[model samples]
Target: MSDLITVEIPLGERSYNVVIGPEALMTVSPLVAEMMQRGRAIIVTDEIVAQHHLAGVKTLLTAQGLTVETITMPPGETSKSFAGLEGVVSRLLDLNVDRNETIIALGGGVIGDLAGFAAAVTKRGVNFIQIPTTLLSQVDSSVGGKTGINTGHGKNFVGAFHQPRMVVADLGLLTTLPDRELLSGYAEIVKAALIDDARLFDSLEKIGVQVFDSRALSQAIAAAVAFKARIVAEDEQERGRRALLNLGHTFGHAFEAEAPKDVIRHGEAVAAGMALAFEYSVQLGVCPAEDAARVIAHLDDIGLPSEAGKLAHTQWDARRLVARMRDDKKNQDGRITLILARGIGNAYIETNVDEEDLVAFLETKLK
Candidate 1:
């Protein structure tokens, strides 16, 4: 009957459920109602989402007899910065939220990330839920317990590991996502696929998408979550296997932080980073030239940019970008480690990656 699949993120005391498919948004209240401890619920969303799905979220929660408060945020990733996080915290204080109250993050990655962080720090810690509205949030950011605000220092530079009580990822909400945002989210799918499943990459090669449909999205989201959940189960603190999830994020973050963040979205920059990684994989003789071409081809087919202006070629301001790299929690013993692939679905962690070698690779291959 239904084409949706659900995956459970198992973390013992921090365990949670990830609900997928078209009926998800409507099912949100009930799904969360079971997990919540009869506590007050605050739904935090962005203005764009408020215009589209906020009413439905409010109505469903109200129908459940839950005391709900709606806090709408200004749109965009800047909302994931320290200032925006502070604003939400202030509002929660204004509402006088108790320690047991739950914060429902009801929009995209920005809202999920920023609101989750607020819930993490408010009065020390409180319960929170994720209703990731966009493709990026649902399949990637929302499922991960990592929550944070970007600093002038770097992307997701300041953050916490406060997991959500539950995640309701309704593919129906993604129907309204802008084409670019859809492609942006797909980058994570590709990242996850390239690391763990060649079959998933083969599916992307066949689909060649610019926008997402609910049928296809339900599969992609479940696959990403399955791999991420497996990694999280083994290494919740990202001390090991989970590093594979960041296959392209190291380069992606350097570019995200190096460029003017206002212009480049996080997922957009990640697309560029994945492309660069593809090229580096080839240079290392780990991947065939054709495989490298396929990576760029798929990204372009999905309306994701393969190259950016300031961050594209040249040396990537190695000092500035690498400075941020050192700040990554993945850094081990003063060395920056990263995940690189030999080919699609053949990723491996390389702890011995030299800075000059990485920088040189970025300059020539990325160029």
Candidate 2:
């Protein structure tokens, strides 16, 4: 059995555990088998991961004596879309997957969100397991149960809070991530460290090891996932504590809005977003200037963007991009709430930003 970290998400009957460990993918049979009221299961992955890892996952499940089917979307953030999700769901129905069946999302965050959304809406609900193959999904997106697809209006505009039955993070997968992709995932851990875990940040800064060390990678994954599990369990519905998880997301999403879609990945935007939020925090007096500099310095140290600023694609569909932030599952009221850092290990919501400030922020950073 994989070493499991159970998160008692307060969604009552919808609660689930997030398992972390070596060879966790093989445990799918018993882990999911116990959760299913039906015998059929479907694996949804992006074509890239499908070509690389789908066979391993499929073989593992089959060896466990579980029946499996696999479907894939192309690689990239854009795949988190209505059309992409429709393809998966359509395939699910065609495969005769039922409400009691399970969906095993075996890729990065994009596939997790798309497949989880399919599970959430399929016959009202279905079990979903997160087999996050990338470092970012292992520690961030895969744990929260927030699933959705992007709209032309913005990113992740359509989705649900459907928790997965289990999450498997294979350190072996991290070994295959590109150097840039690895750094991208590190940005999220950096954001977590800046917000509420200075000790973790300090450790990563002082002793962060490359993926070659299985022990180090496992420790990093466990630590980050444990932190997220605690936050999600406290506020599974994003009513409070969970919002802390968005520390760099606001600025990150905006940076994403200005990008040439896929030219920069989600983690890259998050890296830039962390810097922007830290800058905004210092400017607003919410955080100290020294702290802001430290935040930027750390991201830079990890090869993430500290001053990625923003791209000024004059024709950039700003309104279309900004629209996503407003509707993002993280927003509240008409004002999009942001998790801004006050200092390392301290972050809070700032809803006082006005349109003028936003425009200036966007123009200065994005343009």
Candidate 3:
């Protein structure tokens, strides 16, 4: 195993470490064992991941002299649903999983969110660890304690703030990722930089997609994890500082809800959402148009969905998207809260935004 980079999330009793590096999967057993004394582990993963990584995880845990059980679910955003959540919890119950045992979430964001929520609700909460496989999950979703299942009304509408025991992100696992999935995660990495790290954004812009190269990938993961850890430590429940992490999420979730499901994944919608956010900022006279253009250009250069009009295989309806935003969790008192940028590396929460103004902007974007 190569030297690993560890970012500690300090939350007092709830704090944990995010271990990032190549071949970090090998460290999971020892890490979990250290944090948890004597208990069985239930590995929850998606079917696609099961074919590739399940045996490896089971072998590692078994070698550590820990009993292990595996639960496999179908992969995709759909798995983060109430049905899926119930199924996982029920399976753990059938397995006679004890409160002391840990639930090992061993897949992408979907599996992690599903299993994490299951752990949160089972026996009123059980130990959970994240072994995020995709870049999106590794850098962002895995580190934060925000876990939930999506609802028919909107994304992550029903969930809990369940922190993990630890996060094991093996950058080497990314070598097998499809380019689209890799780019999806890249959007999140860019998101972390755009929120507060101008230098990191500059580095990402310079490297382009080569940020996936071993050294760059490790650095990017460490930086993203560090940024998230700080915010999560300060505002674990997103009452304040942590809301900044949702920079593109409001518009992004709207895009995901309204766009053709297959046409856009979470990261792609977020890439487009970030662009819309900057453009909206420019329209609101808060962010410079040049700054918005720079952000969009970098995203477009990487083949991500940065423009609403350019979204392929999808129909656009600005009114429908506007409606979705109304259902977003970020809204308060019939007013929406958006994370808009003043410029590169500067974003703030803009509340009580007029729906008419948003509708007008969406119309322009669709045009």
Candidate 4:
């Protein structure tokens, strides 16, 4: 028997299920049918995913009598753009994708964010299902209601809080992921563990990067999703506890925006960002220096970048990077909101980040 797990995001009426496992994709059609009685679906995927899973997705939905149409975009971070959003919106309109029908985001985080934002704005909003293929999307982006695109200013700078009707994360699909991409996804699982679950972090340390083993992978994914499910249920709009999910994101996003687009992927930046967050916490006299070192060592053991200097195509400019963080959505009244840690598995939101201190910390990392 296959190991299948489902985590429910208890959001009253807007609540949904994150179904994980090898057979998770099979559940998408029925879930979409329940959400959209018309049995119509327009799949939004990238060219790469289309080559791999688009046909199977069509077959699944078609078996359920759902009329399926697909729109393919070029794969990469560049696809998360105003132009990409506009293109998706236009295609849905052309296909007569009414509000009652559904949009299935059938790729990684990029597809989920772009397609989800399209579903949010089109005809005022439409039902959508998330079929996140990559491990990063599976454990993090797909579960949250965060849907957005990037602008020249920064990553995920433009977007919405629209949740999906269902999230189908087929772990089997991850078997085909490139090793680099797979490690990138592992960074999110590590983030989740560091944010709230010390036990999880301990298990990961013991397991090393062999987390791809069937039992280990399933457990890690379930644990990560469960952690996120609880946080999202408590603070759907990122009002409080939810912000903890962005522990490394604030610094990570700044670096990501400054680095070359095609280079460091989101999770890679996050790995570096997380290390920076821990190191910065030590500088703030918050997290223990030993804790920060432990976290960095684990990330390095897994082949993830633990330092900003290691990132490719990065300009390593502290001032410009800090400028990018100023545009982060978490900021309020010009104060940078950061997710810091007291130690491993104990992250919190700190809104009053001192700019001078932050710049100094970044300066050390730049060179």
Candidate 5:
């Protein structure tokens, strides 16, 4: 096993450590035992992950004298919904879960969001741990406490700010992920670098997608997690600077809301969104064209969708996409809130954006 890199999210009493490295699943048993000395554990996973790591994890915990129960949901974004939440919560209730027992999320973003949200509402918020399996979940969703399901209005519109008790990001689990899924997660890593760590972005530029198959994977994941931990610690509720973390999310969510089911992955939408953000920033005369070009080039080289038009199996409409953006959770007083960049690693929240200009810019991109 490689050396572990622990990133601390200092949220006072609600604080937790994100243990990142190969074979990090070994840490979950000890952490669970420490958290609930007497209560059994409930692992909320998806059908896909249950087939991969569920048996090993369950056995590992049971061996440590911890009683374990499992709830396996269907895979994909459809699982992140009211129906999904109700199913998980109902099972927890049926199992007579107590406030002391912990909910363990054992899959990717969908499982984490669904399980975390279930923990937040079950018994008025029980403790939960995140054992994210995918690259997207490891670097993005697993670290932050943001939990929720998607709504017809927009993605993540209905969710809670419930932090987990701990996050165990096992790099070894990523080995089982398909290349497309791995690339999807890479978008979030790129977003982190675009938000506030130009140095990390530079490293990615030099390393390219090889980061997924090399020692640099650990460093990239740690850097993204550390960046998010700092942002989350400062603004746990996203009241201020933490909004930077949503650099490409606003645009990304709109793409997601409009795209058909299973048509695009969250990370792919985010990749396109980040590209749109940089291009939009350039259009608004805030970010340099060269910077936007570099971002697009990097995304293209990685085979990620850099524009809505570039996304397969969908015809993007500027007005419809803009309508989805208007419903974004970040918007305030009917004005769209966007994270625009002046250049790489210089993202900022911009709330005074003109809707007409946005529509016009999106129209050009669609063409």
Candidate 6:
């Protein structure tokens, strides 16, 4: 095990620590013990993660004299929906969980979102801990308090900014993830660098495929987490600069909405969406064409989905994807909001984007 890295999200009253490294799960028991009032905790996870890490977590908490209950759901994007939220909340209520108790999210992004949202609304609100077992969850979903289930209209359209009391990202758990999953998560890491960290982007470009190497992986995760912590602290409610974090999400979510469940993972969509964002920026003369090409080349080299037409299992329509973007939460006054880059490591929020122009650009990509 390597030395653990702790990144602080300084949100004053809501501030918390995100601990990352191999075997960081060891920190969870003591942290949960401190938050226990009734000495009870509920673990919400998907079946896939439960099979691998659930029993060990239960043993750790029970050793500390805490009563632990678990709610396990199916594994996949479909589980992040109204039905999933209802099932978790209902189970927690049935177990008589109280505000003083804690809810632990123990899986990837889907489990984190579902369980975190459950913690937000149940008993009006309760403290929860994030034990993210996947690379995507460890670097992205687990650190931020943004939690919610998906609606038929779009992804994350119904969610809240409920920060976790603690986030334990055990890198050892990531060793079990498939290569495709690792690649998917790496897209977000690239996104953070593209948003405002040119140095980080440069490092990523040099490291390239070696990012999966342990030391490199740890360093990348720490840098990405630190970047997000700073942005989130400044704009917890996303009133300003924080919107930069959604560099690829607006286009990503639309891809997700049009695709069938589990056909495309969130990170895969973001990878393609990011490529499109840069390409669109180039078309609008806002970003250099060379920068857009570089972004696409990096994504393709990483085996990620870098173009909408290249995304497997779904045939995309430019008009339908544009319609989905209209429902994005970031939009205001019926004008679409997009994150565009002027260059690598320079992304900004662009509002009132011309829909006709967007459709035309997407049409080109489809062809």
TM-score of every model versus the real structure: 0.91, 0.88, 0.96, 0.95, 0.96, 0.96
Q: Which lDDT value does model 2 have at 242?
A: 81
lDDT of 5 by residue, 1-367 (tens): 3477888999999899898887787755676667754557789999999999898888878877788889999998889999999999999999888887778999999999999999999999888999999999999998879999987765677889899988988888888888999999999999999999999999999998688864689889999999999999889998899989888888888887787777888899989999999999998889999999999999999889888878764688899888888887788899999999999999999999899999999899888
Q: Which residue pairs collide in model 5, if any?
A: none
147-202, model 3: which lDDT tens digit per residue? 99988777788999999988999887777789999999999999998889889999
Each model's RMSD to truth, in Å? 2.6, 3.1, 1.5, 1.7, 1.4, 1.6
lDDT of 1 by residue, 62-161 (tens): 7777777888889987788878998999999999888887889999888998999999999999889999888888889998699999877666878899
User: Which regions of candidate 2 are displaced past 4 Å?
Assistant: 1-13, 27-29, 33-38, 209-212, 309-333, 358-367
Question: Which residue pairs in candidate 6 have backbone atoms (N, alpha carbon, C) closer than 3 angstroms, thus clashing?
Answer: none
Tens-digit lDDT track of model 2 for 214-240: 666667777777778778878887888
Q: Per-residue lDDT tens digits of candidate 4, residues 118-195?
A: 999999999888989999999999887999998777678788899998888887778779999998899999999999
lDDT, candidate 3, residue 33? 66
Off by over 4 Å in 3: 35-39
What is candidate 6's CA lDDT for residue 271?
94
CA shift of 356, model 2, Å: 2.5
State each candidate's clash count. 1, 2, 0, 0, 0, 0
The segments of candidate 5 whose C-alpha lies over 4 angstroms from its true place after superposition are none
Q: Note the residue pairs that clash in candidate 2.
A: 154-324, 310-365
> Native-vs-model 2 lDDT?
0.75
Relative to the unseen true structure, what is the Cα RMSD of model 6? Answer: 1.6
**Native RMSD of candidate 3 (Å):** 1.5
Across 127-245, the per-residue lDDT of candidate 6 in tens digits comes to 89998988988889988789998876767878898999999888888877888889889989999999989899889988899988877888899999999999998888888888899
| Candidate 6 ranges beyond 4 A from true positions | none
Of 1 and 4, the candidate ranking higher by TM-score: 4
